[model samples]
Target: MEANKFLDAKGLACPMPIVKTRKAMNDLLSGQILEIHATDKGAKNDLTAWAKSGGHELVKHEEENGILKFWIIKG
Candidate 1:
């Protein structure tokens, strides 16, 4: 899991977090991971749904201190 870029949208809200993640994923190469740090309450569900719909994978996610650390592999 090598991440070429990291997007910290920790204080962002709702769709922005997923939007930012999608934009970053579009710019990433296949097999490259995108590390996302966000606090959006919807991230867990949004990211999961996006990953499924886009045919990508969410490798892992951890939430602590009201922040979510997402490790995603671009499809």
Candidate 2:
């Protein structure tokens, strides 16, 4: 199953994007995928750290057209 979630926090910074993602992920089932779109450069480390601490999985990360994208799976 390729369940996908989208989180758009283009203007938010630091922990905000990751915070919003954590909130959204509370409703997700295990193994569900989340695709986050953020403009903050910190999103890269923030999302990765959160995923590691929370026992989730980070599948991919990239920057395209200035948007920081992340692919994560719920724990």
Candidate 3:
């Protein structure tokens, strides 16, 4: 997916990915998408839940070569 911002949170753990994702999302306008690349396994669930709770949309996600990629559309 095309995103307005790209956040590389690779090599980070747990809450750090979510923390950075939140901060990056804050910089986006409503409807803009933030693409996040993280290595933390927990980020999959955490980011999905965070986006839902924040009224954002989790457009898509995938894991490749030990990396987790997420696309979140700002609400």
Candidate 4:
């Protein structure tokens, strides 16, 4: 899917990916999508829960070559 913004959180650890994703999401209008690329193993779970808790939609996610990609739409 196309995203309004892309965030590279590849080298970031736990809270960092979510932190950056949150900040990036804040800059977008409702229904816009934020695409995040992260290498941290824990980011999948962290982002999934964070998206739900924050009322955003985790529209799509995938793992490729050890990198985790997520597409989230701001609620």
Measured by lDDT, the strongest candidate is 4
User: TM-scores for all candidates?
Assistant: 0.91, 0.91, 0.96, 0.98
RMSD of each: 1.2, 1.6, 0.6, 0.5
| lDDT tens per residue, model 2, 1-23 | 24477888899977789889998
Give the higher-TM-score candidate: 1 or 3.
3
At residue 65, what lDDT does model 2 achieve? 96
Model 4, 27-67: lDDT tens digits are: 99999999999999999999999999999999999999999
Alpha carbon deviation, residue 38, candidate 4 (Å): 0.1
Task: Select the stronger candidate by TM-score from 3 and 4.
Answer: 4
Worst 10 residues of 4 by lDDT: 11-20
In model 4, what are the clashing residue pairs, if there are any? none
User: Model 4 lDDT vs. the true structure?
Assistant: 0.95
Candidates 1 and 3 compared: the better one by lDDT is 3
Q: What lDDT would candidate 2 get against the real structure?
A: 0.87
lDDT of 2 at 8: 87
| lDDT head-to-head 1 vs 4, winner | 4
Question: How does residue 62 of candidate 1 score in lDDT?
Answer: 89
Candidate 1's error at 38, in angstroms? 0.7
Candidate 2 residue spans exceeding 4 A from truth: 1-3
